[model samples]
Target: MRPLASLFKGWFLIRRDLSSSRRLFLTAVSFVLPLALWCLVSYVDWIWHPDIKLQLSSEREGNSTVFTAGDHISPGYYQEMVVATRAENTRLLASTPPPKSSKRANQKLLRQLAPVAISHDWLPYTEAQNDASIYHLWRDIATGTKIPTDPALTPENLDIVKQNWAQLAPLAADFSLASLPETPLLKLIPQGLPANPVYLPAPHEVWRSGWRDFKAVPPEGELSMTQRYQHSLRVILLGFFWACVVGVPIGILCGVFDFFSKLFEPFVDFFRYMPAPTFSTLLVAVLLAGDAPKIALVFIGTVFQMILVVSKTTRLLDPSLLEAAQTLGASPKQMLTRVVIPGILPNLYNDLRILLGWAWTWLVIAELIGVKSGLTEFIETQGRFRNFDRVFPVIILIGVTGFVTDQILSWLHGIIFPWTGRGNPIAQTFFRILFWPFRQISKLSDRAGTPT
Candidate 1:
């Protein structure tokens, strides 16, 4: 009891310490909230599937098999078998033959094997069955070898049992099924049966071999993963570059003078209220209307919002600081370069961080329209073909990339403007809330505005 009490006390102390730690807790909560909401919505059978789906892909011979975890599997050219229960009514209407049944004595066994049976209206194997023999063939496909009363059913004897199974001839020819048929099941085979069904393994049971060289192959072209990533990097870099170029100048110009702010205020307000694509459309019409325009439509969409952020931050600069520098006989260029730029810089960098996120969002929108390259384009490509397996990885990659970039930017901001740390609302609010109890306790130690 004493040890447990001590452990509880230690845990409480650790909790208090974490509560007093810093802004990271708040940021963590902010990050976790979205994921929690996503999970909740997904679990609730909302329009969107939660991120719980896992794609199991396997290659056999020249074909591929994909199994989707959870519900809502896609209909593809590939074969599928669903293991589900048939109600009592369904059993009567289906009139499934006992000889044709794969069911064992157990009710659970019956349910398990029901999915592979054939009725007048239902055939559950990978292919359609025109006869009872076909269903019997599927029944012969034992996932496990049966134990015999006479023999121990050793692996060595199992080989002999497998050799006697004639319904498994195709599999024997192709080296798939190895279980023996003891009931003379192959006697039910029709005289002129088509080639035996290709015994395909389940998605988890596929294997691959080394590639072979094919001479004089026809051209089959598609972008590789590396190529796709290269394209994405280029688009991201270009967006960043344009954002810096456009955002910096606008920020600097508005920070320097009151006149420009007055002139740009209404325009900025109008543009800010207007959708980003509206500016994009106008810009596209003016700058990109020409044949073979150098800048893509995506660049225009991504940069406009950044420009507004830069302009807003610039307009928010402290006028008193500028006046002070001017009063000190600092020349116009010197004041502009020395005072205004440095004063507005912390905010400028913060604006850049926010704009970078916006730029990524716009990149997606841009790719939805005219952008030819980037992660957004990759998503669009996947959506076009309904290849959601490929799509999900790209989505996760974009999120990770954005998150990593934001962290890098935050680190760079810390290095560049150490003094501005105290004033950051996110950081200050985070730390203040974290240490609130400590502050309260410290206040109790003070008497009449004096520290004890």
Candidate 2:
């Protein structure tokens, strides 16, 4: 009970201190405004482009049917085929007797499940490739062979497979018996299809797509969001730890000693101006691949900036406190320990918290350099595959993670430096509000322990 009370008291104090800042409301609004904009852009489809349309026609000549379907934009053909296949599947499913044992049913299904037509256009390229991959997987399953690993399949499609595995298994078995060639089919449906097809998905569709990927297992050879997030956290923390070790001491030295400050200030300032990413080639060459280069990239990014900030903070320390300590017969080391360190510790903590947010910015670029196994990599891969759903969520994840981390560090700063924002009336009010519930709890506990 005492420990719980202590914890509550700590939480209460932190909350009270943070509430002192009227900027918090503005900060919250800043976050909400972007989300509102995102919602607006997504719901309105203000930038949506019209999908390419493909026309397919069949003509009978000399008792032979000639089927033709092609479009100037190749994805148009692939998109039409996908829609047609889905429609054909629905029609077959809706038919009587289920077409379970019919030879014609098997042939038609196989024909509909033919290899996707390749398109030179970039728009349909990935979709066509994905459909082709799915077809191959379906063919393999139908033939009673193991499904080949496909890293390109989005999590949503993967989830669909997992959910309908039982139904698909039998379908695959039925499909295997059909002696169909692996040729591309020219079956096309009507144009001006509803705007809600898989290709031209609305903003909600994009969100749903991303949500599925967020909840689903990543395809073969790709890291899940959880895995990527953990990797990113590890990389950022490792780099931050090393940066502190190197930067903080140097920063302290620069702050306290004029000679040290003169020697290091120019170099730190100059290097910080140069972007950390430009050094990627050198870092990669020297450190080689794997975690070393990535970690080095993060370290390079934060360390120089941290050094300058820490030095500035240390330089800002009150000279009167240092003079008082010296006049009290304290040695140089003693003056630093008693006055300089203590004087700047709170401000330093706040500086480090702000710098930590900057560290996450470097993290995405760092992860891109070597291993390709973090949230940034996931976003890049999904973006290449045009899985904007997966990409958008990971991007949002980065922002949310950084925001939450910053808030948590803010709370910690308040706890560590109780004097921070002490005189504000808003803080006083917040303190009272936070204490009320705990006070009531303590009173109830005391009453229960006494008479009952």
Candidate 3:
């Protein structure tokens, strides 16, 4: 109880000391309010823009029937179609097996049994049925089920079905069925419900689906999310390392030597304008695929930009500082090593941190060029499969990882340049908040030990 009281007291003291407490509060609210709004919008079925309730109609014209989107189909039309199909099937079964020469006639009769209006686009009923069939077929394939086909299905139709089946097979093999909702709320809504025909999934459902995908291991030799993240991190770090090695030295030379700056500045500036992804084919041709091309892609993306930034940072050094070092009998090498490097170290750290984030932005493009074994690959593949649940989570994961990485770098920067944080009000407030409870405990101990 005493510790808890002290903790609250410390929080109050820290809060009082931080003059920007209101700002901090607002910042927190800024994050929370959007999330709250997202949850609200997702959970509640608010009718913003209602779906256009299409009224489809069909009229007989000569030998064919014309259907229009504005026309309405009577319930009896569905019943008549069902009866006709059943009667035709019965007659086909009752008669002697058709000769091989009558195969075309059988196909024609099958088409008649499945008579669809020429203007199906205008027929809501036909469109809905078609959509539902396609949806179910996709669902079945996604769940690793082989679709059942009629034995008497024509060769042309069978070929078309086979082509679709082949295309969806990879998705089925890769898809994690556990991601789907066991009791989907969307199923409760009627197919032709007012306002919207499509289901707007709840936030919880999306989160659950994402979670499932995060934990799922793809079949075959494909990498999981964890493995992919590691690979991505490795590629980013390697590319960053190489970029720093080359760019920093060149930047320093450009900053220190007027001649070098004049010579290289134009070339670097020109290349910077050309996007890195455009070099993908060239990189592939030179590096010949594999991790080399991917790494080269990341390197190309970051290097030119890093060089320019570093050079500008170096050039911004105070002239007085350089003069003072020179006056103190400091050698050129010693001045660079001791004075210049230390002075720019803090800003350089900040620049590197910012550039590291930029490097992550290039990761997807890099991974796409040659190797597809990162978070980008998961996102791209799942996105193509229309697994928004999986895609959203991977995106969120990337954001969270970047945020954590930035924070870690910020902590490192403070450790390396302790003086920088001393003047920063935000940092001061943060440290006070961090150590307030310990300070409170110390105060209590001091009071108890005093001769009272």
Top candidate, metric TM-score: 2
| Lowest lDDT block of 10, candidate 3 | 184-193
Q: In model 3, which runs have C-alpha deviations exceeding 4 angstroms?
A: 1-18, 47-201, 423-452
Model 3 per-residue lDDT tens digits across residues 288-400: 87778888888989999988998888888887898999999999998888787888888888888899999998888999886676888888986775555557777888898
Instruction: In candidate 3, list every pair of residues with a backbone clash.
Output: 51-195, 55-70, 56-71, 56-72, 57-71, 69-122
Counting clashing residue pairs in each candidate, in order, gives 1, 1, 6
Error of 3 at 57 (Å): 24
Question: lDDT by residue for model 2 over 329-382, one digit each (tens)?
Answer: 999989888888888999898888888899998998998986576888877886
Task: Report the C-alpha displacement of residue 250, candidate 3, in angstroms.
Answer: 1.4
What's the lDDT for all of these models?
0.47, 0.63, 0.61
Give the clashing pairs for model 1: 161-180
| Candidate ordering by TM-score (highest first) | 2, 3, 1
lDDT of 1 by residue, 1-452 (tens): 99877544543344455433344766788989976764444335443432222222111222244332211333322222211111222343355342342222111121222222321113332223233343343334433422332212334323433443434554333322233322222111000101112221111111110010011122246455556566665665676676578657865676556676567655766655656555555555555542112134445554556666666676677878778988999999998789877877888787777767766666665544433455566567655645443456666667788889988788667555757663455655566688799988888777556855
Kindly report which residue stretches of model 2 are placed more than 4 angstroms away from their true locations once superposed.
Answer: 1-32, 45-173, 181-207, 218-222, 422-452
